[model samples]
Structures are given as structure tokens and as C-alpha cells.
Target chain A: MRLFISFILCVISIAKVQADSFVVDKVYHPYVLPNEQEFEWRLFSRQTDEGNKLAQHIAYGFALSERVMFEAYILGERNENDSDDYGLKSYEAEVRWMLTEQGELWADWGALFELEKQHDSNDWEATAALLFEKEIGKTSLTMNFFMVYEWGDNSRESMKNEFRLQYRYRFLPQLQPAIELYTGHNYLGIGPAFMGIQRFDRQKQLKWEMGFIVGFNGNNKDNALRVAIEYEF
Target chain B: MFKWKVNITSCLLLFSCAVFAQRPEFVLEIKDHLFYPAEIHIPKNKKVKLVIYNYDATPEEFDSFDLNREKVIFPHRKSIIFIGPLPEGRYSFFGEYHPNTAKGVVIVDDTTTVNQPLEESSHVD
Candidate 1:
């Protein structure tokens, strides 16, 4: 228990570093339904002093079993300053493992591993993350701690760490409100998010999320808008 | 690295074996957006299998926040899910499409027998 507390403190301290960059993205939960499959699309747009940058990701995910899932994504980005040089940016593959049974532990535990390769370049990045979630009454708290390593001929060989946290209220099955926080090197953002689900016939549902995040640093006017839609069957 | 891979694979095999092992089975029928047995009793602290048969023409999603289980049961089809190894308590579930009528409760009790006789009460909305 002491070790766990120390580890959490360490992660928080790492996240307390200064802010400038915007890396606000999805906050994952620690549950995987058996034999589940999903198709998802996400959009992230950021407005900064440099210009507006937009990225979109399309992904397909499927469960291998009750405890494991795999997903692949195609990413694209367009920068306003780049003058229409927008196309495929990267390809990514990810795996998630549910490490603990729900409600059987103090907190549910999971792990995520991701590998990404840049298009038309020898730049690659890998990330390993720990996912934790706990339910308290009508609310749920979730956290992701990520360790990322970047390498390749076109990129600097470096290692980085990041964290994302979400606190959500379960008002109803269809609609939920949440507060999300993201922290990385030179990136700190907090915002309100809303997510909802619309269920169709047997094992099919559509989920949607929207969030607007603002950076904390005063030196730069940095903010981001993110939207995601998922179809699960 | 090879040793680590082997160790991980072994652990996963063991876990999967435990999960797929045969367990007590219970059946719940859905017709006209109502559960036939409004409540079920299962042994506490033991994993059990639940097979839901949907006779309605429209699909329904079986959802339970207390049990942390959710699945979609297609019309005229059956779906399976595992629940339990839980403490003694009452867990409620409802059909997402017809929350008013398609509702049921799982009663986990230490003294309850496996596959207990179904109660005659049928709840409809």
C-alpha cells in the first residue's frame, strides 16, 4: 500500500511540470467487454499563436477475448500554415489488457501499449500506459499514466511521460458529464467534457464525446477542441 | 525477452482456463420487453453463467451498473455473459431500450442454491 501511494505521488509530481503544448486526447477506462468490436473516429483541433492545427483518427478495434483488445488507427493532420499539405500522417496499433476484475479490487487496473509509425518517414514512437479506474457512488474516477519513447532517423531519440485524468458523473445511461485533465511535457489542460450513448438493437450502440480544453500557460493562447464518435457492436 | 514472453503466455493461458471453466448456468427469457423471472438467486462468491434468450422482434441491451455487465441480446437470439464471484447483495439490471418494463434483479446469497426455481412473477412495462 505504501508503495502504491509513493507511485501515485511520483506520477502526480511528474505531471506538475510547466505548460505550453496541447496534447489533450482520450481518457480511457479499464473495462473491456467480451467479443466486442467497434469503429471509432476522433477529431482534435487546436488554435495557437502559430495557427490552427487539426488531426483526425479513424480506428477499428476488436476484442481478442474477455480481457484483451486490439485496435488499429489511421491518422491524418492538416496545418493551416502548411498550405494544404494535408494527408495521411501516421499509422498506429494498440493493445489493451484488463488486468483486474471489475469491483473485485480496490481499483480496476489495465494496461495499454501502442506503436505508431510516421508516414513517408522513419519516425516511430511507442507508448506503454497504466490505466486505473474506481467507481464512487454515482461518479467514476479514471487515470492514465503513459511512458512514451520516440526514435527514428527523422526524430530525436527521447523519452517522455504524460498523464490524463477524468472524473465523470453517471447521471443516466445515455448522458454523462465529466471533467478532464491532461499533462505532458510543456502541456497542461483542463476542461469540461460530455459523453453520451445511443443504443440500438443487440450489442450495437453509438457513443459520442465533445470537449473544449484550455492551456494554463499565460505566454501562449493555446486551446483545443476535441470530438469523438464510436460505433460498437 | 524470450523468457518474459513465455511467462506472460503461460499466465494468460492459466487465466483463460479459469474463466472458461464450466460454471453454474441460469437462463433468463425476454419477451415483449419484460423479463420472465423478475429476480434470480445465485450463490455468492462464485462465478456463474447467464444466458439471456430474447423472443421479442426488437433487440435489447441488458445493462447492470452494479454488476458492471452489459450486453446486447438480439431479437430471437441468445446471448451469454458471466457475472458474480460477488458478495451477498441485490444487483438490478434493465433493458436499455425498455427501461420501464424490462427490469430484473440478481440476488446473490450465500445460502442460495444453484439454478434455484424461477419465481412466477413477470414484470412488464
Candidate 2:
């Protein structure tokens, strides 16, 4: 309850700021492991509403400013009798800053810093990426090539980097489906994938996404599926 | 016979004007999270008028890397851009905010993509 009240107060305060002062021009990026279709604050709600607490994965989020969005998800030992998973899984938070409104030569974009912890690990690993995107008509395309770093007693200082390219279409202002391709060297292992999302009210929403992660060389391929609802006070 | 001759002359004039009036136009339509008629190709050095129409209540933008253009397209409204005598290459565009939902392409080259090529395609999405 306290968390909810704080979020509402934060929103009310941020509302006083002008849209031009920050780079948060749009919202959502439609794909999973990628981005959902970005809609503006005015269109945050449309097809569906973010569901109840049980329906949501063990997580919490705060939209501090238009340009900054933050989230944390947990995954510990699953207790069949318990309603919520209290285990601390990997931690991740992102901030999408608008660098510019200028043309392609100086493309304005969003970048994120994400951290993850292994199931039984103590130290946290991180992924740093830069997303340069543009909007054409009702379509938005983004090119992201980020590096994943490992941190541990036995881990290297800087581990590896990967590249991703994605394209999304907003068929309806609210219903957006997306396609994505990714690889280690931008082509190490290529895969085809998609995701869908909807938010019916201001900060309240629900989103669903699926991913077909294809691997390269001797690596195995796998499919990831996720469904969740979120509510903001 | 006189009536038939007059009708034929008028029809011919209309046809000629229609063919001559054909102007190249490009539109990126967002439907079901994908741009209908995803790919468009136009010849280089042609006077072209491009308009993007977003029917959804959410606003979208037409962005391209090859052509060096970016314009915000509001919901239920139209965004317009003009290109003249340009180079040849593949120029891709998409909605900046919704990269996951909207996308399309524009291929500018010496060749054209529509049949009966009428200078370029005056009708496209």
C-alpha cells in the first residue's frame, strides 16, 4: 500500500514537467527479449488492463519519469503452497532516454542497463545496450547491439557482446506484434520471433510475449513464453 | 455516328490526362501491427510525394535511414514528405516509438515495382 501511494505521488509530481525537457517521447516496445511497440502516454491503455497481483510475475516497477522506467522481478525456490514466489531471482532495470529528435545522422534513441544474478550465485552480472530507433508512419524499427558482462570471483572482467535487430508494426494503435533476429556477432545464431502487449489505463496494464531463441553451431535452441498483468496506483 | 464520335474523343482525352496526371505517391499503412504493402520501389530522380496515414488512435512516425528522413504521424491523421531526384538504394522506415509494432520499406533504384508503371505508383499504402 505504501509503495502504491508513493508511485502515485511521484507521478503527480512528474506530471508538472514538460514533455520537451526529457527524451521519453514514446512508450512500450512490443517484443520480448527485445522491445514492445512503443505507444505514447495518451495511448497507454487500449486492448486490455494489467491484471491482478497473483496474475503478475513476482515483480514490481516504478515509472519515475517519462524518460525513465524501472522494474524488478524475482525467481527463488517455487513453493507450491505459496501464492507468491519470494525468492530473489535476477534483477533488471532499464531507463530509455531520448537523445535527440534530430534526423538519422544524429538519430535519437534509448539505452538500458540490466543486471542478472545466477540461480545460486552471489555476484550480479550485467547487460549494457544502446537502442537507436526511428518511427516511420505507424511503424517503428530499432537496431540494438549490446554487450553482456560477467562478474564473479572466477569471471572475466568483460565477457561477451551480442547484436539484435528488430522491427515492429502497430496494426491497431493498441495491438502491436513484433518480429526479431539476433546473434552473437550480429549473425552468430539467427532466430525468428514475436510478442504482443496492451495497457487499458494510465500506468495499469497487461502484456504477453513469446520467443523462439535459435542458437548457433553446437548450441541448443529453445522457446520462451511469458504472460503477465500489471497495476499502477 | 456523330454521338459515337464525340464520345470516343472525350474518352481519349480523359484517358490521356489520367495517364499524364499519374504522380508517384507512397503511403505506409499500419494494420494489425504490420505495414500493408511492406515494400515499395521507385526510380531515382523522380518527383515523389509520400504520405503516411496512421488509422490507429496511437500516433506513429515514418523513419528511414537510407533516405535521411523522419516524421511523426499522428493517429487518424496524415504526415507528408517530399523527395526529388534522389540516389539509388534501399531505404527502410518504421515507427520510432513502436519499433516492435510498425515497420515498412522504400527501395529507390532505377527499376520500378508496379505493373503498367505509370511513371511510378500513384496508388500504394
Candidate 3:
């Protein structure tokens, strides 16, 4: 009886964590519109061992082509943390374009183009990557590999690439069990990210989503959890 | 006089671009327990964007089995819906909140370019 109860509890926890990100086997950029270029506003707050911190992501997304969507975000103050409070933090923006959609009997695939500011240093510094996603049954997976280059300073001319992979299992409606792996040019490690989304009564116009992440590397560690709410405005 | 002509030509070009750049549009309004217009005729293989106006102040979701898209139009607010260049077919849709009240079809046919579903016989005029 005890073992059965423990198993049930574990399953519930995993299911809740998966709700924030896995639905279509795609590495859904933390901030992008899949179809329509509507103006979307999102506010995120998370708690780490350091303190309670909040950040806002204001973005606009619209389809550039029949199959392509472009989105840009300017991350406002990520203050509240010991490290962030010391100096001014630069705003970050990411633009992702979905290329194509593919699927098989039990598997599906999607391709995307993602550009993000690198090193969190300057807006000019950008990285471009090809993101691929595939899934089998309730298990969804994603792999994103990107190459970075300095805008004005191409002295090194060397391309720094990074890869991120996530696996999620959907057990309940709007809930899943998730595990995310990330490794890149300047940093390396793995973490857990969660996704949860719920629709309002009668209409799905109002959707609420939240995400949790805990990451650790060989060097310094970052174990943070994020919660965000959006009203499809 | 030559400069005025140049200015006039530029204005015309800009206007053309603006008109052509916008997506194809449709409007679906709920009235008398049914979708006004009953059907939407759109250009085949093109983007069919729609504005769903639920004037009744009741929440509703536009759902289409053939169009492969869905959107919830809140009470009294207009919801923008975008559908794609699907092959010629009759796509049926309905209101999830009030399925009995709102229902319609989106016919994607290149040969039938009429924006209103006034029947094939009527188009003969």
C-alpha cells in the first residue's frame, strides 16, 4: 500500500512539471507566437535560493510568411537577485521562425530558426540556431543547436555552438512530466523545466501557463523556478 | 509639374502596396441563434483571416474540424482568427460555447471566389 501511494505521488508531481512546455514536440521558444502576430505581454516571477525576483517580457509576434512567425522581446529589469542588483542588466530579445512541420505514425517533427542575444552582454551580440523537435506517443522531445558570433567584433571568427534537449511525457490534460538538458559554448549542464497551462471556463481565450527550472553546471549553479501568467491579450 | 507627377505616382504605389499586403479578411457575427452569412467564400490556397464578433455578450469559441484552427471569442469582444491555404473543401465550424447558436462553413475553392455563400445558382447572375 505504501509503495503504491508513493508511486502515485511521484507521478502527480512529474505531471504538474510538464505542463509548462510540452504540447507539440517543438522547443517552443520561451517567447514566440506560433501563428498570428498579435501583441502579447507576459510577466514572470521566480524564486531561487537567493531571493524572490520578477521580470517582464513584452513582445510582439506576427507571421512574416505563410509558415514563418517572427517575435521580438525586451526583457525588463531582472532585479531582486544579489548579482542582478549590483549593476544594470541588459535586456534580451529572441526571434524564432518555424520552418516546417513533419510527422510519422508515432513520431512528429518540426524545424525552427531562433536568434538570441548571447552572453547576456549586448543586444548586438546574437546567436542563430536550428531547432528540431520530434515525438513518439505521449513522449515529446526537442533538440536545439545554435552558433554565436559577435556583431562588430569577429576577431575570433570562431563559431560557438550550443545544444539543448528536452523530453516530456504528457499524462494528464494540460500537464506533463519534463526534463530539459542544456549545453553550450560558454556554459554546460542539465536542468529540469516545468510547464503547466489551463484554459478558462466555456472559452479558451484566457490561457494560464507557468514554468519551473532548476539548473546546475560544473562551475557555478543556477537553480531557479519561474511562474508566469498570460491572458492571451 | 514633373515633381507633382512623381509625388502622385509614389502615393499610388504606396497605396497599392498597403492594400495588397493585408491578409484576406472575413467577418463572422452571431445573430438569431445562427452565424450571419451562414458561409464564408474565400480564395483558395490563401490566408483567410477572420474577425469573430460575438455581439450577444456571451463567451464563444470558433471551432472548425476541416480548417484545423480554433479561437475563443469572448463576450462582446472581437476575436481574430487566421486560417490557411487549405485545398478545396467544405470546412464546417461552430461555436463551442454556443454550438447550437453559431455554426457555419468555410469553403476554400479557387473556382468559387465569392466572399458570401449566396449559392452556386445565384452566382450565375
Point to the candidate with the largest DockQ.
Answer: 1
Predictions ranked by DockQ, top down? 1, 3, 2
Tell me the tens digit of each residue's lDDT in model 1 across B81-123.
Answer: 6776778899999997798899999999975455643333332
CAPRI tier of model 1: incorrect
lDDT of 3 by residue, B8-95 (tens): 9999999999877666667778654467778888777676667666676555667654453555555566656666656677878887
Question: What's model 1's TM-score?
Answer: 0.72
- For candidate 3, lDDT tens digit of each residue in A131-184? 655544445576665555545332334445455666766554356557765444
TM-score of each: 0.72, 0.42, 0.47
| Regions of candidate 2 where Cα sits further than 4 Å from its true position | A1-57, A76-88, A101-106, A117-120, A185-192, A216-233, B1-125
Task: Please give the CA lDDT of all the candidate structures.
Answer: 0.83, 0.49, 0.53
C-alpha RMSD between model 1 and the true structure:
8.9
Which 10 consecutive residues of model 3 chain A have the lowest summed lDDT? A17-26
Question: Positional deviation of B11 in candidate 1, in angstroms?
Answer: 27
lDDT of 1 by residue, A1-233 (tens): 79966976577567656322346889998878766899999999988888989999999999998689999999999986585777899999999999986655558899999999999999999999999998765688999998888899988888888888888888766788999888887777789999888877656789999998987767898898999999998
Tens digit per residue, CA lDDT, model 2, B10-110 = 99999999886655666556655466668877778674656555666765656554454545555666655554445676667676657765677777788
RMSD in Å for candidate 3, one decimal?
15.0
Best first by lDDT, ranked: 1, 3, 2
